[model samples]
Target: MFGAVPALLTYYWCMKMPETARYMALVARNAKQAASDVSKVMQVEIEAEEEKVDKIGTASSNSFGLFTREFAQRHGLHLLGTSVCWFLLDIAYINNLFQKDIFSAIGWLPKAETMNAIHEVYRVAMSQTIIALCGTIPRYWFTVVFIDYIDKFTIQLMGFFFMTVFMFALAIPYDHWLSNSAGFLIMYSLTFFFANFGPNATTFVVPAEIFPEKLRLNCHSISAASGKLVAIVGALGFPYAAQNKDPSKTDADYPPGNGVRNSLFLLGGINCLGIFFTFLVPECKGKSLEEITGEKEEADANDMQQASSTQTFPV
Candidate 1:
């Protein structure tokens, strides 16, 4: 009975849809009737009511329309790259997130179990909160007041560097407290902090800035969807890894060491990979979005000119 609900809802919506005026005019070639029908359905008076009216002639001609033949391929690739990176980053980000519960499994529990979950959740939530806070406030403080102008690349690279190192560190065995399980957690926390400051925020901004105005929405959607895909992959795989991980064995037995450590390593590598990928992207600091993309065209033109200039003259 519950399964039939979806079909019933779909049928209800299907009945509400108006007939297509484009189909009627193009297929039936009855412009006068199509305009009249469209006018009533849309409640907008189309200026001219003619039997041979083209729909494209109407007031609804969208310039620079997304996914149009001219815009699709270059636009699609531009968006696809952003989308893939976002997917991988978000997957790595969120997968490690929910899997934090495995910390408890590793006997990294807090004093009171209830307080522990609350604090754990708070720490997880607040870590991002703090990073966002720092990003918003400290950026100005660091750049303006301190004269410490860290570029986008530097911040991203630092996040990647630390992520890789910590991940590798987590791969080492730490059976005893003095061996420093808590220290690993601290490093993970710090990496997460830097990620928000760097690639996590900038990657999205970079792609959106680089693509043409026509392709912005498509690029943004693809990038966002890619991030979600990464999240799903990480979420699904991390748990299986954690359950299979034998903490009793040395950390190396698992993929990156112990499950937690492995997770850190995965995140660290992914973060750094995201940084490396940023190099392929055109850097757009201090420039208008138009200028950023325009530079690429200008660069290509220059290369063509240089090639032409280098051609050997007939002897």
Candidate 2:
């Protein structure tokens, strides 16, 4: 309820903000409108490009639709990189988010039927809150501080690698950890910590940085949608797999281990696979958007005039 209230307020605030100047200029091709909106906010006079003129740095022929061969030849791998990483990361992420197996594993979580319904909900929320405060929140801050210095690629790779290692450690000795509640909790928290500190944050940040301004928003939208789609898969898949009986177990009470251990092994393998896809992603730190994407219209605009380069007169 506390979280929902702020989101509602923020939605209201966002609704009141004006359309961005970038969309008006690039997507709508309404330079006048974009300039007007920008100038009003900036309190400055500015010239608007005529609708038919080519953008200053880019030739008209340089542009291509996203689905065109030119785009595929140039950026298809980049798109694939973002989509694959987002998908793999979210599968692991959403499983952890939706499963809450850590609580059950630690043996501290009371079954829902054993507790008052409200108390059960409170216990779940409070347990998750502790994980968030001690593990999730700190990791996010760590990402924010080091994303530029250490770079998103390195962070995400390290995060995925560590997460894989930890999950395997937890899953392979599942029975052992179940008996050791304190160690189980520590191990569980490290996964969350690495997740936030790694690809979970980088995936969101890099998509917004590495595309041309004209197409950046669309690319990011596609990447994020891929993540959500994978989340749906995780939601449906993890629970089903967790409940499956292991074929190797004969005891009815201990039917073959529902495939939880196998799923962890799978998740770890997916993380390992994600590393290959991640290599397709460019290292975007310290580079301007144009430099990253190789579309220099905005950056080159200041240097070009009509048909000739403007020569600066030395003062």
Per-residue lDDT of model 2, residues 45-130, tens digit only? 97887643346224422367677897777678898999889998998886565344457545767654578978878888887887
lDDT assessment of candidate 1: 0.56
TM-score quality measure for candidate 2: 0.79
CA RMSD of each candidate after superposition:
11.9, 5.0
Q: Write down the TM-score for model 1.
A: 0.55
lDDT of 1 by residue, 52-132 (tens): 243222212223456576455444555554665666567556644443444554455442345766686775565445444
TM-scores for all candidates: the values are: 0.55, 0.79
Output the lDDT of residue 114, model 1. Answer: 53
In every candidate, how many clashes are there? 8, 3
Model 2 Cα displacement at 155 (Å)?
Answer: 2.1
Native-to-model Cα distance after best TM-score fit, residue 255 in candidate 1, in Å:
16
Measured on C-alpha atoms, candidate 2 has an lDDT of 0.75
